[model samples]
Target: MRYDIPIWKKSNLTLDEAAAYTGVGVCKLREMSNDEDCEFVLWIGSKRLLKRKKLDEYIEDMYSI
Candidate 1:
């Protein structure tokens, strides 16, 4: 058996993956995730994960960030 996670099928994404998926810079994604007001960040220990669907909703709602 084999399992593969295509980007669109993921519920969470690493900064690198998020950058590739959204065309956002890794530094910028990190910066945004660090914000106290950010709505798309998920923390697992010290690792920050971006919520894929929420991120899509955020990007869709944003004119600029």
Candidate 2:
């Protein structure tokens, strides 16, 4: 018998979550969030929340070489 698993959807993510997704530590993520060169990251109030699509795009852009 096969079991069906439910898919989870994430709209917004905390700094920690974004860090894990990018394989970077929270401290580094914070630094990237502040860096003007990193356009993929966005700040929501005091918290840094990364859009899922944007993060993916950033990763692809980084690995294009």
Candidate 3:
């Protein structure tokens, strides 16, 4: 079996990059990062990064509901 991944999902993404890639807006992405239940967000020092794969999974889960 084989799987294919989008180019954007090949690495971690900063908040702004995530916004552009996911089209979810910067403010909402920030809110999701602060929300305790959001599992796709990661914070390092003062910088926030989103795991591209996790963000894709999260959006998929949301729409499956």
lDDT: which candidate is best?
1
- Clash pairs of candidate 2? none
Model 3 residue 53 lDDT score? 89
**C-alpha lDDT of all candidate models, in order:** 0.94, 0.65, 0.80
**Model 2 lDDT-worst window of ten:** 3-12
User: For candidate 2, lDDT tens digit of each residue in 16-47?
Assistant: 77666667678876766677666666676776
Per-residue lDDT value at 9 in model 2: 50
How much is 15 displaced in model 3, in angstroms?
Answer: 1.1
Question: TM-score rank, highest first?
Answer: 1, 3, 2
lDDT tens digits, residue span 7-64, model 3: 4755778888888898898888888788777788777887888888899898887853
lDDT over C-alpha atoms for residue 60 of model 2: 75
- Where model 1 places Cα greater than 4 Å from the true spot, the runs are none
Q: What does the lDDT read for residue 41 in candidate 1? A: 97
**Could you estimate the TM-score for every candidate?**
0.90, 0.62, 0.75
Q: In lDDT terms, how accurate is model 2? A: 0.65
